[model samples]
Structures are given as structure tokens and as C-alpha cells.
Target: MVYITEELVRRRAEHNECEIFSLEEVSLHQQDIEKIEHIDRWCRDLRILYLQNNLIPRIENLGRLKKLEYLNLALNNIEVIENLEGCESLQKLDLTVNFVGCLSSVESLQHNIHLRELFLVGNPCTEFEGYREYVVTSLPHLKCLDGTEITRSERIRAFQGLVEVKRRVWEQEKEYLRRRAKEKEEAHRKTTGEQERKGSKPGFDGRWYTDINNTVYVQCPGLEENKENQEAAENTKLKMTVPDLEEEQRREEEFWHTPCPFTPESRLEAHRHLEEKRKAKEKEEMKPKTPRTLITAEGRVMNVNEPKLEFSLTEDEENNAIVLDLAVYRHLDTSLIDVDVQPTYVRVQIKGKIFQIVLPAEVQPDSSSAQRSQTTGHLVLTMPRVEGEIKVTKGASRPARVCETGRSSSSEGQNRKGHVPERLEVDPSLHTAPDYANIVPRQRAKEGPLERARTPPAASSSSLSDGFEDDLDVPPLI
Candidate 1:
């Protein structure tokens, strides 16, 4: 059976940019999941869960979800409602289109006083006589049932009819239970018989195994969200022939149309079919992918967006550089990314996927720098252009540092107008010492040379010698 695994939960959580421990919402719908497990322990903080359209027969291993507010178990094989009394915050529950026949089992939900909405449409119990009156009176806190609002008058009427309706409901519930017991036995028998004949359960050649209209959509490998049509075309090309293709399709249709019992083996059969398809898909994906033609035979570089990531490339006039800002996934780790800076083009490889783009102008690969943003995760590349002309605006040079002496407020405001004072912009990553000697404002080329700092007047004849002649350093005093 396809049980919920930690790897699946963790992968879904990673895709959502959160860890399992802190995950508040999760969607495990239409995964062909036959059982629910691991999620209660892994996602204790989960508030919303979607487990719709699966083969899950029982609801268990979910009592620890105290924070759970909504649970959707529609289109499953769930026959009874139990073991949900611990969902203290549950406000809504969806069991629509399930096989829930035991109407009395919903009494287990009477403990869930916080439940405001309950959906049981298309279940066997919903067809039972006086189903609505029985359920409305049972779950007094329920405001909506099967998408219909439960008015105050409806509640009072249901309470008035509860006496007679409860007896009829109990009788119908017993009959459904007896019939389900027989189905269980018959399904179990068929499961074992098929297992014995096959030696082991074998997967059928189909994309999905539908039982009682519960469809599980299986995904193929190397096929992204937008590549479904391409994969389908590939599959058609591989499978379609003339005479045998039609015969095979006819047989497949006949097999599915033939009524079959929904049992453990049948549900597991779907899982195994998907498992085999996954293996075949992996084998197909392992074939070497033809890299996009970025460089032609004539040594001409071409631009390509192979990975289909959004990016912007612009000419930075002020810096005389080519700036490329690539919108990468924010949660992507740097270790999984590799960048290659070239004079003609830049290439970035993310987890074996390639994204290469040609530059508009020639650049200096040695002078190029690439950095990722901490918040936005945009990869900004600054590549100094090799052929770009550096245009300098002709203006009077201002003093790098103004050591103002006896200056008035008016003079200070006027002299410093449209001027920016220099500050020590230290970068922690670039381990270099500050150039203290260069801090003094030097005279500009058009300006006259300023007076240099003079030597100290108090320099004595003894210390004036400094380290020039130190009498052999006085026997090298330690």
C-alpha cells in the first residue's frame, strides 16, 4: 500500500519552504495514498490537511494533531468515523463520496464540540432514511452539513424528529454494516486468490487505477508541470502501432470496464503500477539530455534560456559594467548552484540544470563578480565591459576630506553643498588593512599643491637620530 512516508512529507515541506516541524498546511491529495501515517508525528502544528481522492480505508494515527482545524477525507474508502475525538480545534471535516455506512459511528464526533462544518455527501449513510435529521441532532455544533446551512429551525425540527429517526437510522446503519461485512470478506478472498495466482502482485499498464470513481493522478518523471502534453506525445509515439495497438487498447478497456471489487490488493495494484511507471520513467530520464546549442561551429555565441528562469540584463553606464539579475528560487542552497563567467557568455548550473545566456557586449571574465541576494535570492552579476567607454563627467574636484578650521555655519553649508563626505566603507569579507596614509586630502591636478605637514619642533638631537643610528641597538635590548 502507498503509505505516507517521511521522505514524501519532507519533500512537500521543502517545496513549501518550511520544515515539517513548523508546517501548518499540507496537501496529500490524489497521491494514491492507501494509508495515513507519519504526518501526525512529523507535522504536529498542521492546521489544514487535504487527503482527498485516495484509497485510505481508515482514519487513524491523527489524534496528535491538536492544532488541526480542517480535515478533508473525501473520495476514500473510509467506512466509519472514529479516533478523531482528539482533534480539539477541528472546525470542518469532509468525508464526501466515501464508503462510510456506519451512521452511528459519527457519534464519535459528538466530543468534537468545535466542529462547525461536516460533509458526508455521496456516502452510503447519506442515502439512509432521516440521515440529515439524525446527523443534525447528533452534531449540535455543526452549522453546515454537505454545503447546506443548518438553520435554528432545522435544528429544532431535527431534535423533534430525533426520537423516531434515530431508530430508523440505527436499523439502516445495521443493514449497511452487514452488507459491508460481506463485501469485506469477499474482497479479502479475491485479494488472496489473485496474490496466489500471480505469485506476487503485478502492476497493470495504466497511468491511473480508478476504483469507485476515486482517481489517483500519477506523475511521470522528467515531465514538469507544463510538459504533460510532451510526455503524452512521447508515450503515444512509443506505444502506438497499427493492428496490435488497437487490440491492446481494446483489451485494456475491457479489463477496466469489467466490474471489480475495491480491496487491499486493488488499491495496492494501483500503487505498484505507479511504482513500475516511476522506474521506467527514471530509466527514460537517465538518457543523456542534448544540451542547448549555445555556441555555433563558427564560434558565435548564442543566447539560451534552457531552464526557463526569468532574468534581466542591462548595461550599467555609471559602473561601466553589464549587470544580470537572475530570479532564482529563494530557498535554493548556494552549494547546489555553479556559475561560469565567460567573456562572451555566462552559464549557471542549478542542480545539473543549465541556464546560459550570451552577453550583449564583450566582458572581462577575471573582473566579473557574482553575488546572491540574502532575501530575494536574485543572482546579480557585475561584469566589467571590455569595450565600454568610461565617460567621466567634467566637474571641479572636491576635497576628499574637509578638515574645516574656524568655519562658520554659512560657510559649512555652502562649501558642502552637493558634496558627499567620505566614510570608511569596510567590507568584512575582503580582509584588507585600512590605508591610513591615503586618508589626507591630496591637492588636485588643477589646484595648487597644499603645504605638507611639518616635522615636530620638539624633536631632540638624541631622538632625532630615530632608528638611523642606534648604537648597534644597545646590544639588542629585549
Candidate 2:
């Protein structure tokens, strides 16, 4: 084993141009050194020392280095951490790969208040239950452990885990003590019976009789020695089994008074009841639900009986097209409106009004186009008509508007001041139109009457116009 001599220390100090008195660091690692010597007396001002990777059995002879801030004794045979009480300035300690087997070994460094980083990886203590927690809780000032920064959550968990480990250990110890006491009691009973049989005397009638007063004297030739031995054994058995018996009785009472008892059938029944409840809930969820009606943001249900918006559907046989006119009175952002036109249904939702119209006949929805009039505020949807009869299927229940002349009733006309006799042209193709439902009128407009009479009356549908004049006063269509 190579030893660190004073001559070698002097030579190293000269080579590094460091004087012995002011030397701040020393590295004697991997020198096959078994013991640390002369360093405390020669280099008293040393601040950092590396004695790792050696066969050092224990940490010792470093108390004189009061200014030491860093110490690395890793990869050594350090079974316990002791003799570190004078390392007041130590900020980092590396004892990794060492044989620190117990928390008490780590507890020896609790006085190191300035220790900020510690490395105990590859140590035997790592195998202990709650070792990390024990170390962290024991050394509250440690900032980093085993190359990882200690966090608050880890600290809290460590404390709780340590408590649980200690509780389990205590319970195990109690059980072991109880078992030992029981074994000792059994052994003591056997010994006492053997002694009594050996101490028995034969009476004149040829029967063996144990005289309690002279039992010790009869068992052994030395009466006092045998009595003392018997008394000591009895005292030991009492000391061992008394507490165990009391603890057993207390535990039994606690169990007997417990409010709930654990049984497999009860647990199975509870699980089955929960499963049945879950299945019932699933079945209830699987039931069909009715479509929800639209409601305003202010909690008022949208009026389906009396719609706020009125629109007209006109079929042009000459052009083979269908025109839908929707009156838009409220100032609305066109970007907010969404319209979906299918072959069988047309859905329009703008602001608060939602309308879905089942078509009287199938139309080409892909070829449909919609345009908004800037001046009149009318949204017009034009769809190419297909050659087919109206299917007459049930549609969403909604207030309907119909005119005898088969013309659209204009909101502008109803609010007009002067009575203008206007004649509306009716399409002959629309005479066979089915009842149209599920239409919501737009908000009332503040505009004058539109020129509905501008278009010339068609000759094919004149009778429908005459019928409208004959029955001019018709109630609102339901």
C-alpha cells in the first residue's frame, strides 16, 4: 500500500507551487492508500480533498481541515459516515458507491448545515425501505441528492412514506416480540414440568408426590441454587408474556367492537348492486330522446305557432326552377347565418331564428344558389326544379301563410299607408303544391310596400287570381 508521506506531500506542493501552509486542495485518489495521515497536520488550510477510488475503510483523520468545502470519498469501503462533525464548511459531499447500510450512518452528517449537495447512490442504504425519504427528512438542508434536485413534492412524499415505513416496522417488531414471548412461554412450561417431575418424592404407599415446599430441594442437591433458578425463570416468563397477553386482549376487544365486519359475500353483493345500478343507468341513457326546440339566449322558447319571419315559395314552370324568398328585417351579419339545403329539406338558421322546410317535391340542391338583396333585405334562394310529383310527407309543425291568389304576402304591403291595388302573377305549376310548413318569418321591417304588381299577370293562372279577389278576406293560414 502506498502511503502519503510528508516528503511526497512536500514534493507535490513544490510541483504545484503551493506552500504547505496555504495549500487549498489535495488529490490523493487511486494511490492504493489504506489510511489518511499527515494531511491534517501538513495541509491545515485545505478546502477541497479527493480521496476516492481507494481502499479506505472508513472516513477519519479529516477534522483539522476546517475550511474544507468539498470532499469526495466515492468508490471506497465507507460502511458508516462518522467523524464528520468538524466539516462545518462542507458544501458538497460525494460518498457514492460506498457501503452506507443504515439511516443512522447518514444521520452522522446531520450537523453539516452548509452541505448543499450529497451523492449516496450505489450505497447499501439505497436498498432500505424509504431510504431516500429518511435521508431527505433527516437532512433538511440538502439541496440536491444523488445528482437530482430535491423538490417540495418529493420531500412531502418522503416524509409520509417514512412514517408508513416506520409504522410497519414497529408492527413487525411487536409481532416478533409476541412470537418470541409465546415460544419462551412454551419452553418455560416444559422446563417447569420436567423440574416438578424430577423433584417428586415416593411416599411409603409407593406413589410419587410433589411437595411444593421441598420441591427445589428434591429436584437438585443445592436447594438455594435450584430455587433461585426457578424464580428467575418465572420472573423472565412473566416479564415476556404479561405485555403480550394484555396487547392480545386489547386487540381482541377492538375487533369485537368494530362496527363493520369484512366478508366476501357482502363485498360481492355490494359490487353486484353497483353493477346493476350502472347497467340501469346505461339503459336509461340508451333510450331515444325527442329533438330539442330552439330557444333564445334570454330563455324564451322560439314561437313555432306564430313565426317571426314569413317567406314565399314560387315554382316557375317555364324556367323549370323554384324560387324561395325569405324576408330579412333585422340588421344581421350575413356571415353568422348558416344554410344547409338538401334535396328533401332546406334548413336555415340565422341569429335566433331556425327554420327547416321539407320540400313539397325533390329539387336539385347542388345546383341551388342564394343571394341577398342589399336594398330590400331579402334573402332569395333559387333551386333548379326536377320533374316529379309532390311526395306529401309529414313535416315539422310550423305556422303557414297562404294567399288565395297563390302570391306572397309582403310585410311591406301590410305596413304601407296608401292602398295600392296590386295584382300578383301565379304559377300554374304551383296549383298542385302541397301544404308547406316549418317556416319562421323575419322580424318586422320598417320599409314601404314592394311593387308586387309590377310583373304582368300570366294567362294560364288567371282563375287563381280571380279566386283570390273573390275571397280577399282570408284568415291567417295555420
Candidate 3:
């Protein structure tokens, strides 16, 4: 029980500058001191303290010395680094040849961010692999570790090595948790089985038992005799009910044949009546035809006119896109055309006519573009295809479009009074041409006469009546 005392402090301070005993540094090495008590009361201004080679098992109670900058506890029995949180100005710490076994023992020093040098040689943690690297990496501001200055390359290697070490430690922790959970589940099952056994009623065979007073008792001795009596009574009851059961069965047959309410025929007739009524109601619902309408995002109703809009989807392998060609008989203001493209569908609205095409394959919406050809008056939309299959939703219900006459000029050679002219099938080969001619005006001038001849005729021309057809086969576009 060696304790630090006031007499000892005064005696130790005898060699100081003054007899008044105000010293900045104190050396109490090899003093056989096992406990440090009340040292701060006399040496409150201590800047350095050396208690090396003592029996102090823990570092504590030095927090009041706010200006403590250097502390050496080397060659002591200290096992943990703690209670120095108030030493805010501490910059150097030496704990060499101690019992510290893990890096966590020094973690309390992390709060002292200004610490620059650390010495922990001959400690149990020094035997670990990458011990110097671990300490240097953990305290990045530390310039010297174990009296050796840290290098740039060592810091880099420490950072890289810590990644693998942390991953391995994390995997080990996860497996430990899994094993603990399995152990808990097994323990719970055993507990439940024990409880079930305790709650169940005990079974009884023909057996004897002895009471506390040593009196003997027999259980279920007449079980076989009781079973024989029960069987004999059941046979007597069956003999008396035979004639009555046959009479009752005959009456039930007679009731089934009787017609009015309880007979099977009447139930069959009622079921047939309900089925006929259902069929008649379904037939009545199918008598009237209703026009299908679609509502736009702007809350406007548009009538679905069959055969009014015609479009085709052609795969342009040269352009790596799927081209959609729509015939527009009415002149459209190019600026008012609204096109919305999604992965699964494309919606195009020009004036009053709206066309929504659901694509069979997914497409990159950001790469899709719509252009109206000035030469043929056709709207061509190019969408670059993606990898996966696209899911298309059914079209929404649209409001009815109000009938307006002469709001816009019709295309040339189109009938003005009668039903709208049917759309003529255009040559699919026209889509395979290079898009530069339509997208860029400078490229159109470079087209030779042979290329110009291959261009499709304008929408106003009667090209379908020429009776000239190409041998190229075009698949139907949905």
C-alpha cells in the first residue's frame, strides 16, 4: 500500500530552485509507489511529470493539471490509457514497457488531437502485426511513433492495409452474431418443449400407485369390461331402429317426387330462370354502341377516329434506331407540335390530332427526337432502343373533341367535303436514308440526283396511283 504523501512531495522538491517548492518538472522514478493520490494539490502547475518504474496500475486523477504537456509513465504497471481528457494541451506521451495489449487501450488520447508524439515500445500491443502502421494511421497527426518518424509511404501503406483488416473484422463479427442467434433459437425451442411437457395431462394405463401413507390404488382396472358393455348396448339399439329407418327412407323418397316447393325439379327450374335473366341482361347491354374517347394531359377530350391516323414502325439498323413515320393530312404548325417520349411509349400531338404509340421494346427517352419532313410533310420520330423489354400501360380515357370546321387548312389534293381520305401506304425504304438531309440543310444540298430520285413523293402527290411497286417487302407496323 505505498501512497504518495505531502511529506514525500516536500522532500522530493528539496533540490528545486527554491525552498518554497514551486517546480515545473517532477521526477519520482523508482519510488516503489503503488498509488498516486492528491499530487495535483501541490503540483498544479506541473508541465512535465516522470513517474517511471513505479507500481501504478492505472493512469487517473491528473485531469486538474490543465497545462500538462508532457507525461512519462514508462516502465510502470499501467494497463489502460484513460482519465487524461482534461489535459487539453498534452503534446507528448510516453508509456513504453507497459502492459497495454490492444490499440483500444490508447483510444482515450484521440480527444487530445494536438498530441504529436507517442511512445509505446515493449508493450504487449507492439507484438501485433502492423502495430506501428496501425498506431500511425489511427493518430494521423502523430509525427513520431515509438521514437521513429513516420514516412509518407508508410502512411499510404497503412491506409491501404486498414481496408482489408476492417473488412475481415466485419465479416468475423457478422458470423459471430449469426452463431449467437442460432444458439438463442435452439435454447428457445428447448424451453418450449419443456413447457409443453409440463402442461400436458398424464396418460394412464392399467397400473397401480402408492400414496404417501403407503396405501395402494389401482387405475382403470375395469376398462376392458366397460368397452364390452358399450358394444352390447349399441347392437340392441341398432336392432330396434332397422324397421323405423327403412320407413323414414321411403317417406323421404316420396317427398322428393312431390312437386311444388321442396322437389329437386322446382330448384332446377329456379336456377334455369336466374341464368336466362342474366343472359338477357347481358344482351340488352350490348345493343347500344358508345364512341371511345381519350383524355389528354391538359384535360381536353379527343375523339378516337378510326383510320384517320396511320403510322409505321421501321427498324433502321444503319441509324441504330426505331423510326416512327406518321402521315399528317392537315397542315401542322411545327412549333405547336408536342412530343413526349418515354421508355415504353411515345405521344405526339399536332393541332387536334393526337397519336400515342406504345413501343414494343424499351428506348432511351433522352436520345429520342421528332422531326417533320418539309419535303413529304410526314412526321418522323427516331428513338434509340435499349436492352430490356419495355412494359406498356393501356391508354388513358380521353375527353371528346369538339367538332370544328375550317380551323386549319387541309393538305393539297385532299377532299374538303366528304369523309377524310384513307392513308396511303408509303415506301418503307425512304426511312433508311441518311437523316442528315432532313436534320441539316447543308447536307441536303450535297445530295446527288440519284439520291434525290430515291426520296419518297410528297404527301399531296398521287404517287399511290402510279401502279409502280418495289420488290422490297415491308412488315406491318403496330
lDDT of 2 by residue, 1-478 (tens): 4688976676767655857878888787876576778888888889989898876777888887789999999877676788888988999999988755544667778888999999989875566566667778889999999999999998888887777766654454455446545655664564456446557666899645656533232233344367657765444432222225577568557634655422222233344345656886899899986655655578543434123578888887677777878886647778866777777667777774676665655789889999988887778888887667564579896543457756445754576668886556578976975546514333345322222233233346644655454332333222
Q: How high is each candidate's TM-score? A: 0.48, 0.35, 0.34
lDDT of 3: 0.67
| TM-score winner | 1
Q: How does candidate 3 fare on TM-score? A: 0.34
Compose the digit string of candidate 3's lDDT tens values, residues 391-426: 366998664332234332333224465766644445
- Positional deviation of 145 in candidate 3, in angstroms? 0.6
Measured over all alpha carbons after superposition, the RMSD of each candidate to the real structure, in angstroms, is 20.6, 30.3, 35.5
Report the candidate with higher lDDT, 1 versus 3.
Answer: 1
Whichever of 1 and 3 has more TM-score, that candidate is 1
Residue 66 error, candidate 1, Å: 1.4
Q: How close to the true structure is residue 327 of candidate 1, measured as C-alpha lDDT?
A: 93
Instruction: Write down the RMSD of candidate 2 (Cα, Å).
Output: 30.3
Best by lDDT: 1
